[model samples]
Target: MNRRGFLIGLAAVPVITGAGVSVAASRYTPDYEPLLARLLALQGKTLQSSGSWNPSQIFQHLAQSVQGSLEGFPEHKAAWFSHTVGPLALQVFKAAGAMQHPLDQPIPGMAALDPALSVDYALGHLVATLQNFNEATGLQPHFAYGNLSKADYLAAHQLHIEQHLSQISVVA
Candidate 1:
C-alpha cells in the first residue's frame, strides 16, 4: 500500500478494534454549593431515626457497585476495542461511580473510612475513570461497544446522578 494508504489503513485498525468512538467530556459536575446548601438545611435535624435510604447512602452504594463492575473487567479487556450494550452499560456505570466522602464532616457510617476520606469519593472515581478511559483510547477510540465513547458514559453517569437526586428529593 502507498504511504497514505498505509496510514489510512492503520487508522482503520483502531476503529475496527472499537477504539475510535467519540466520548464527550462531562458537564454534570457535582455542584457542591447546592448540595451543601441542602445538607445544611438538615443541620441539627437528625436523619429520621430509621434505616430509610438517604442520598448519601444511595450515592455510596451506587459508587461501590460501579467500582465492583470496573474491577470485574478482564485485564485484556481493559484495552480491548469493541462496542456494544454491555460496554455502554459499563461506561455509564463507570461514570456514575464516585468516591466522594463527607467533605466537611464525618458521615454517619464512615467508621472504617477516615472521616477525612469522605471528600467527593464518587466524583473522584468518575474523574479517575475518565482519565483511564482517555489514556487507554483517545476520543472516539474503538471499543467493544460500537461507537461507545467516554461522552456516552459521562452522559449516562449524569443521568443516573440526576435520577438519584430526584429520588432524594422525593424522600426528603
Candidate 2:
C-alpha cells in the first residue's frame, strides 16, 4: 500500500516471472546437440528399433520431418484443425518445452519409408537433414502445426527426434 512497497512489488514481478519462464524452458528444452551426437556415435553399429519401423525407416522418417519443415510438408491437417487445435497443441508443447505423440505414427502424406535402407546411409541422411535445418533461413509451413517461427520449428524438431530416438537401441 505504501509507495516504497508498491515499487518493490513491481520490481519483483519480472524477476519472479522470469524465474518461472526459465524453469519451464529448462524443463522442456530439447537436447538437440547431444541427441545428434548419440545418433552419430551409433554409426556402423547394429541398431534395432523397438517400435513398428526398423532403424533405417525411423531415420528416414525423421529426416523427412526435418526436411519438410524447410521445404514444406506434402500434406496438412484440415484447415480447421491447423488453425485451431494444432496451434494450441504447439503452444502447450512450447510451454512445457517438449512434445508427446504416438511413437510409431507416420508423418501425414509422406511417401512410405524404405525398410531395406542401411542404417549408416539413413543416419547420414538424417545428419545432413539436421544440418540443413539448422542453416535454413526461411521455413515452410508445418502440416499440422501450421506456421511457426524458427525457434518453434527447432523445438518441434528436437521433440520429434527425441521421440524417435526412444525406440532405437544398439545391438552390438
Candidate 3:
C-alpha cells in the first residue's frame, strides 16, 4: 500500500490510549501514533521487566510479530484454531482493546531470544518493523489469527505490543 492508501485505511482506527491489562503507561492502541511515541519516550530510559523476559526480549518478540506480518511467520497454530478460535480471540481482544497471553511463550517455531540482546537494537528493530508494516501489501497470514485485513492486522500488532509493554517499567 502507498502512503496515502495506508493513511486512508487507517482513517477510522480507534485510539487505544490506556486500553490495557497492564499498569504500564503504554496502553493499547491499534494505531501507531501512541505506540511509536511511547517507544520514543523509552529510548533513553532504564527499563526493567516484571515478566520472565527482559525488556530487550519483549521488544524483540514484538518486532518478530510485526515482522511476521510482512515476511510471514515460521509456524502456525492448527488451522481449526486459526479459522475458528483465532478470529474469535482477535475480536475479543479488540472489543476490550487489550490482549492477554502468556508472556514467556515464544512464537511457535522461533528460536529463543538472546539474553544479551541489546535494548537499543531490539527497540529500533520494532520501530522499523512498524514503519515497514505501514506500507506493507499482501500481509501474510497471522500465526493464529489466520488471514486478516490490514486494519485488523494493525490492531493485532498494537494490542500484542500493548500487552507486552505492560511487563516493562522505566526506572525513575
Candidate 4:
C-alpha cells in the first residue's frame, strides 16, 4: 500500500525468484536418452521445415554447439556476461525445462551453415558429436554460459535440441 512497502516488495522479487530457480535447477534431472531417442526417431521421417534453417542446417548448428564444448568455440561473450547473465539464463532454462532463444541464430563466431550439408549427414554428425561430448574428459567453457558441469551441459544441450525440434515436424 505505502510507497516504501511497494519498493520493499519489488526488491524482494529477485530474491524470491532466485530461490525458485535454484530449487528448480537442483531438482531437475538430466536425461540424455530423450535426446538420442529423438534423433533416432528422425532416422527415416520426411520432415518439413518451418524455420529459416533447413533440417540439415538446424542439425548442423546443433552439432556445432556440442563440438564447441569438446574442442572449443571460436569466441565467447565477455567474462562478465558468460559468468553472470549466461548462467542466470541457463538457470531459468533448467528451471523451466526448456530454452527460449533466437531459433535461427547461429553460434557466434562459427562458420556459416553449408547448404550442401545433407540432412542425413548433419543428423549423423550430431549423433556422433553428442557421443564424443559424452566420452570426452574436459569440457570447454560455453561461449555464453561459461563452464558447466557435464550434467548441466547435457541438460542444456537436450533443452536446446528440444527447442529446435519445435521448428520442424515429420510429414506424413
Candidate 5:
C-alpha cells in the first residue's frame, strides 16, 4: 500500500476499536441490576483513587446523586439553562452512551461529604440507593437536566458511575 493508504488504514483502527467498545458497553444497560452486581463484586476490595475523591467518597457521591433523583435535587440550574444547555448536554452524552463532567465538583446545595466515611458504609449506601431508585415509580426533576424519564435517569446514572469507576484502581 502507498503511504497515504497505509496512514488512512491506521487512522481507522482506533475508530473501529472505539465503536466496538461502545457497542459492548451499551449492551450492558446501566440500571440497578447491573450496577448492583458490579458493586457486589467489589465488596471488601481495597482500591486506590486516581481522582480527587477516594473510593468511599466516590461511592457516597454516587449514592447521593441516585438519592437525589428520587428526592428533588437540593439546588437546580436556572430554568433557561436547564431547558436549553442542560438538556442538550444530556442528549449529547446519551447519544454517545458516555458522560463527561468535572469530577471534583459536588452536587449543588448538598451538604458537605464526610471524607472519613468507610468504603463499606459508602458502598452500602450506594447499593441501597440504587435499589430504592429502581423501585421508585416517580422521579423528581434533575438539577441540571430538569425532568428525566426513568430510562434516562438509569442511563445517566450508569454513565456517571462508569466515568467515576475509571478513576478507581484495585489495590493489590
Candidate 6:
C-alpha cells in the first residue's frame, strides 16, 4: 500500500480499536480509594434514609428482574450484559467516585427500604461494589447470563445500583 493508504489504515485502526478499548475500560470492577472517599463523605448520615431502598435490595431486585427478563429471552442474556450491565456499571462507578459516603456492608432491612433509603444505598453501593471488585481476587464466578471478569461483574453489580438510584430520583 502507498504511504497515504497506510496512514489512512493507521487512523482507522485507532478508531476501531479505541471503540473496543473504551468498552473494556468502561467495564466495572471495584476501585478502592475513590469509592472509600465517597463512603466517608456520608460521615454521620444514615447512608440511607426513610423512603429509600438499600444496596442489597437493589442487588436482589435487579438480579430477580434480570432473571425474569431473561426467562424467555435466553439468547439475549449476553447482549444484555454487554449493552445494559456493562455501560451502566461503568457509569455507576464514575458517579460513585464523585460521592461522599457509599455503603458496602448490608444495611439491615434494606430490602424494604423507602425511596429515600434506596437512593442513598444505591449511590453508596455504586461505589462500594466497585471497591469490592477492585479488592477482589481470582476468577469471577459465572452467572446464568455468562462469565464475567471481575471488572464486568462489578460493572453489572453497579448497573443494579444505578437502576435503583434512578428509581429513587424519579420519586424524589
| C-alpha TM-score for every candidate | 0.31, 0.79, 0.81, 0.91, 0.81, 0.34
**Model 5: how far residue 35 lies from native, Å:** 2.0
Largest lDDT belongs to which candidate? 4
Task: Report the lDDT tens digits of candidate 4 across residue range 11-41.
Answer: 9999998999989988777788777988988
Can you write out model 3's per-residue Cα lDDT over 1-172, one digit (the tens) per residue?
A: 8999988667635324223322232243477788789888888778999999999999999888998899899999999999978977787787777889999899988767976988988899899999899878889999999999898898998888989999999999
Q: How does model 5 score by TM-score?
A: 0.81
lDDT of 6 by residue, 1-172 (tens): 9999999999999677556655655543454455356444543454332234454355444443333222322233355675655444444444443212233333222233233345445545444444444555654333333445555554444444443444332221
In order, the Cα lDDT scores of the candidates are 0.41, 0.84, 0.84, 0.91, 0.85, 0.44
**Per-residue lDDT for 28-55 in model 5, tens only?**
4556677779888888999889989999
Alpha-carbon shift of residue 52 in model 4 (angstroms): 1.0
Once superposed on the true structure, which residue ranges of model 2 sit more than 4 Å away at CA?
Answer: 1-27
Clashes of each: 35, 1, 0, 0, 0, 22
Error of 6 at 96 (Å): 15
The runs of at least 3 residues in candidate 4 whose Cα sits more than 4 Å from the true structure, single-residue gaps closed, are: 1-12
Clashing pairs for model 3 are none
Candidate 5 local lDDT, residue 54: 90
Off by over 4 Å in 1: 1-52, 65-147, 169-172
